[model samples]
Target: MSQHVLALPSPIDLAAAAFTLPLFSLVLAALIIAGTLFVPRLHNRAGGTASPTAPVTARYRPEHRALGISAIAVILVFAVENIVRGYLLNLSDIVEWWQYATPIFAAVLCLAMTLALIVLKGAHQPERPVVPTTRRTWLSFSPRAVLIGASAAFIALLGTTVAAGLASSSDDRGRFIYLEIPVPNTEIEPLRPWFYGWDFGVPVLICLAALAVVTWATLRRNAMRPYLRPETVTAERLARIQVASGAVSIATAAVLLALGGAFRFIGRSGSLSQLTIGNDDTIYDMVWKYAEFAAVARYLAPALEITGFVLLLFVAIRLLHRPTPEGHGLRPQPSAQPETVR
Candidate 1:
């Protein structure tokens, strides 16, 4: 019988774990704080009546409030779980299955929440046919404008990141490191350009498309205002949906961008280390460069996400408080009869 020996993890892997735990904790804290501030406000506003006799609005309020509460609850749970995981990682060498499954659980919750919002009752109302009119477009203080601008900025950032990666000598074809255990000899695998594009580029483009669609919907809904059902599909409802979707999209894009930037920096450092191994400057210099870049990304990514969340909250509040236009209330106006000749 041959005895088996278990090898311990590398120091570098442990160091990376320690670094990521704090970084993730900070991001989660930011998200939880933001949700705590905004979700309650949204929930409160959901209870307010848009019109005195709007039964549909009254009935829909509870569900809206529930959705807001559920979202906030999820964030709270995620934050708590993250903190616990960080603590446990420090205490024990053994990784639990739940730690690995946390992300999968979070993703499932998000998908379920999205599906609930989509299939939830009170989404549709009887369509009111009215003539559509064009309104003068103004970019100032407009949610649609903000979304469009943000989408464009994300696209631009994606392009810049791609260009940066492409121009890097380190990014030359057939240059990647793959880890192999037990076997002493292993060659570095090729990190194809498509991998970077697929990881970062696809997400940015998807978010861009989502923002574009939301912007279009906003414009269409505003232009066809008299035609949309006032009781159910109000401007405020549309704004709420947009805010939720926008927050998700913005956060996702920022995270992906940060990850892509960090990876590119690390890749460059790895390549530099390989080149400067026997030189006067050691690999630590290359590592320092990556650390500096990652530090900037750590703060910048959260700031961007928080800013987007705040902006969306502001938009949602504005839409919720917007005054109902004349003839747009729940009570239908009496149609004037043709005057008969006496």
Candidate 2:
């Protein structure tokens, strides 16, 4: 029997691939935010000014500053998380559960931080408005289709996690299983990669729980905050909604990418297990149909990851956009009229 030498990936390469998305997210957010600093803030039309056409001086709201700070905090925390994970990955050759959980966890953290900042922004609303206005719910500002899509994506994530847990065997840990195949007339048996299962589903589920909690709090807080005039209220809500939308988009992308990764690995394992050294081999342990299913499933991975990357870029674009002013800070002052000889 000839010795079969197989080439395998180094631990460092695998670690780098695992961390690529997270690092990309952090850098992208930072660059976009930094670029946004150059964009000038818009001012509302002046009221009771000598010139009605003149623009009012822009008032820097504390809420905007707080929101910006929170965004910065998110990327910083994620950077720290990547550093720790890289250290841990370096310490061991074995794939750990945390490695798989890292990107999804970062996505969830982003969502939570974004929502928390929105709530903080609402808290800083001025007590007195230029005109009396009724309190408005956050739902009024939110796009219903987007909310529905986000919910669906979250539910799909849960379903995928459950499927991964059920499909995974505890004995293999998180790595793909190796099966022994024998060459006839010889005592030699070769081990090859086979079925894949995820043991880190529980950690992902926990992250999802945190995400749900944060989303609930944001909605509740936004509805309870005092309202300003329709014009002011609309602009603020739009800003909040844009931020929130970006968060949701990234979260949804995370879910898709996670599902795709799980499917891809499972399919690859299944397909690789079908390798035969001789024409008549006796390693029929894997179900042919299941392997085929996984093979088909793997095709979805690239598409999912691409979609996720697009969403990340969308987040960058959203961050670069500053909200336009809908109205002046105070009611438009009456324009000076030409004094007539009386």
- Number of the top-ranking candidate, with TM-score as the measure: 2
* Tens digits of lDDT, candidate 1, 1-342: 999999998999875554444344345445554565567565444323334325433543443444344344434544567578766556442223243223224433543444354344424543554322333232211355545555565564556445434433322343321111111132333222222232333343444454444444433332222323433334333434433443343333333334333343334333332323255583232222233443455445444434433433333343344335442345533552221111
TM-score, cand. 1 vs. native: 0.42
Q: Measured by TM-score, how close is model 2 to the native structure?
A: 0.60
Q: Where does candidate 2 stray beyond 4 Å?
A: 1-93, 129-138, 172-198, 278-285, 323-342
Q: What TM-scores do the predictions have?
A: 0.42, 0.60
Candidate 2: Cα lDDT at 63? 30
Best by lDDT: 2
lDDT of 1 at 271: 34
lDDT of each: 0.39, 0.50
In candidate 2, the residue pairs with backbone N, CA or C atoms under 3 Å apart (3 or more residues apart, or in different chains) clash, namely 47-332, 47-333, 48-333
Per-candidate clash tally: 0, 3
Name the lDDT of candidate 2: 0.50
